[model samples]
Structure formats: structure tokens, C-alpha cells
Target: MTRNRVLRQSKLLCAKGVFECEDLTTLNHGVFMSVKRKMSDEIKSVWSRNGANSYKEARDVVHRVEWEDYQHWLDLQWPKK
Candidate 1:
């Protein structure tokens, strides 16, 4: 099968949370699982409202939350690395 076909098949298999096919070995399966877990967490955090009154209000809060000093925090965490 082609690369696209393999990727499509792998996506379908991942939907079922199982890798019974030989083409998708344990290593590939684990990588997909790890990616899925991370993506799920990111999606949950992005869509979470944290008790906001409405979707628009939640979006406004997220946009207004400042990260202006994020570089300072990063520099503190990793000095000259």
C-alpha cells in the first residue's frame, strides 16, 4: 500500500484504540497513542470554560490572559541552554 493509504488505515485503527494489523506494529501503535493523549489534553484545555458564563466570555478571558512575561519565565527555566 501507498504511504497515504497506510496513514488512513492507521487512523482508522487508532479510532478503535486497537492495532490488530501487522502493518501497525507495537512501536507505531504506542506513538499514535501518545500523540492521541497529548492532543486530547490540548483540546480539553483549549475548549474548557472554567465556569465562564458563555462561550464568548470564555474566549474573551482566554485572549485577555497575558503572556507578556513568558520569555522571562523561559529564560529562568533554561539559562543559556
Candidate 2:
């Protein structure tokens, strides 16, 4: 896939309350620990209202992200600092 498609899907998932995009490295696992963070009420409403299709699309994007082998991103996300 293309770079644009990956970014778009990540944004979609971020909007769904399924994930966050602020630090993208941790997402390599498909599911991130940060998913436990509480979303605002408005975000919750939008997340709940999304259809199964959206969930599937987000999953696909996640898989792609994982396959990309985020070595550099992981370094940035987990810098020695």
C-alpha cells in the first residue's frame, strides 16, 4: 500500500477510539497498551456508533502497520532519553 493510505487509516482508527496516533510506534503490536486511556464522551459516542465495516478497515490498517516493521519509529517512540 501507499504512505497516504496508511496515514489515513491510522487517523480513522484514532477517531474511532480504538487507538491513538500521538506516538505511533507502540501500535506495531496491532493493539497498543495506550488503548486503555479514557476517551472523551463525544469520542465514545462516535466510537460506539461506528459500523462493523469501519472496525474491519481499521484492523486491516493495523495489520499493515505491524508488517511494516517499525524499527526506526520504535526507536523514536522509545528513545533512550
lDDT of 1 at 49: 23
Q: List clash counts for every candidate, in order.
A: 0, 0
Question: Cα deviation in Å at residue 2, candidate 1?
Answer: 10
Writing each residue's lDDT as its tens digit, candidate 2 over 1-81 gives: 564465557667767776533333334332332121221211222221111111122223321223343343244332232
Tens-place lDDT per residue, model 1, 1-81, is 564575557658778885433444453334333333433423222221221111123234332212353233233322222
Model 2: CA > 4 A from native? 2-4, 20-81
Clashes in model 1: which pairs? none
Query: TM-scores of all models?
Result: 0.25, 0.18
Residue pair clashes in candidate 2: none
